[model samples]
Target: MSDAVQTLTIVIPLQVKPRGGRKAMVRPGVLALERRQDVTLIKAVARAFRWRRMLESGRFATINELAAAEKINASYVSRVLRLTLLAPDIVEAILDGRQAPGLDLPRLLAGFPLAWEKQRASLSPA
Candidate 1:
């Protein structure tokens, strides 16, 4: 071996594609999987369900009362309460961090079809 200057080259093989408009590197025939948990959305969903439970269990007399106790707006509380009406599978997906790309607390609060089937169809696993 000589202590002379030498150049080296290296090439790494990878496949990059867009997932939900974000680039991801994946192996052939394998989709890039992201289990990145949306903590904000998860907490919002959990709080919504918990709030609904409080009202149903008679722990809170009304949304106004709950809102006041929680230090949040009644209208916002009302909107969050609607999360309880989401399809079971949708809720499960949310809990398990497997919901569709666009599903989030804001989107859910925007409103959805009251029918479970429609909800499933709109927010099915992707």
Candidate 2:
């Protein structure tokens, strides 16, 4: 054999982005290999609507009572209840696993514009 050496190199194009308070590697024009659905966000949104319906139906006299029934903190329940005010399209995107990459439960729960139009604008990925 000749006293020669050969080298091979490989490169991957990826971007680091913040996803739900965590950093994740993202490749351009590539779909995730696994489910993109955010289970925590979906669960929170579902709970918000369910709580809203319960309150509307007089099933719960107050948030505190609802919180007690759910065994969740009252403050947490209140924060989650705000999800009921999200724009319908946003909710649909979330449920469909097509929400903006940056959108997450913490961002949603932290609060968003009350106006639907503003919400869409504000919640979009930068």
Against the hidden reference, what TM-scores do the models get?
0.70, 0.72
lDDT of each: 0.83, 0.88
- Per-residue alpha-carbon lDDT of candidate 2 for residues 1-126, written as tens digits (9 for 90 to 100): 887888899999987877779988989654452257789999999999999999999999999999999898999999999999999999988887888887999999888999998998987544
**Most accurate candidate by lDDT:** 2
Q: Model 2 Cα RMSD, Å?
A: 9.4
For residues 80-102, write the lDDT of model 1, one tens digit per residue.
88888888888877877788887
* Number of the top TM-score candidate: 2
TM-score of 2: 0.72
Clashing pairs in 1: none
